[model samples]
Target: MSEVAVRMRLLQQSFDAFDESAAARLGLNRTDLRCLDLILAKDPMAAGELTTAAKLSPAATTTAIDRLERAGFVTRSRDAANRRRVLVAATEAARAAEREVYGPLGEAGTSALRRYGEEQLAVIIDFLETARRVQEEQTARLKKLPVRE
Candidate 1:
């Protein structure tokens, strides 16, 4: 494998491990916690948009939303513009839960970033931007391809 592939795999593993540990602490599976995290970041999204953003299949997204709604962590309503569309929004309970779970992790990450000098931070940001652009381009290319199966 190439160096970039090796690095990407390592980063993905590290992220998965951290997310699993955090989810366990909060009594949630990784998917459940991730759904909550996205809703917390940008609420009032249509169900289809949530499915796309969460990278989940339509059925899986609906299931996740159902679970969250049952747990009182989110609410769903018909979009005023389109009654056929359902919009999902986080409840206060969900926001508070997210803060409780992620606040410490955010603080620690911020502290680590703070250890870098301005030039080092700029380099890090530039690398991240490059990675983001690469991923976006790959996604666009893949999306244009017809399904082989």
Candidate 2:
């Protein structure tokens, strides 16, 4: 595999391990925890936006939101301007849960970045921004493609 692919795989493995360990501690499944985290990160997102961000089908997103609401981790409200629109937001409990779960991981990442000098850190940030742009372009391209056998 290419170096980028290898690095991405390693990063994904590390993230999955971290998430699984945290999920066990929180007594929640990885998916449930992820949904809560996303809600915490971006409050009052429409149900459709949640489905797109979570890469889940509409039905799965609805079920996930239902579970989160029942667990008191999130709440759903109708948009004041658009009553037909449903928005989901994280509860205070969910914010606390995120801090408890990901605070250490964030600290570790920050420490690693600090290990690099300012110039190196700047380069790393530029590379990450470029990667983000490239990923967005690729996603748009893929969305435009027709299904194939």
Question: Highest lDDT, which number?
Answer: 1
lDDT of 1 at 54: 88
Cα lDDT tens digits for candidate 2, 9-70: 79869979988998788777888788877877789789988899888999999999998888
The residue-by-residue lDDT of candidate 1 on 1-149, one tens digit each, is 49978998799798899899877876677887888888887888898988998899999999999988887889999999999999999999888877787888789899989989999999999988998899899999999999998
TM-score of 1: 0.79
Q: Give the C-alpha miss distance for residue 21 in model 2, angstroms.
A: 1.9
Instruction: Write down the RMSD of all candidates, one decimal each.
Output: 3.1, 2.9
Model 1 residue runs over 4 Å out of place are 1-9, 135-149
Stretches of candidate 2 off by over 4 Å are 1-8, 130-149
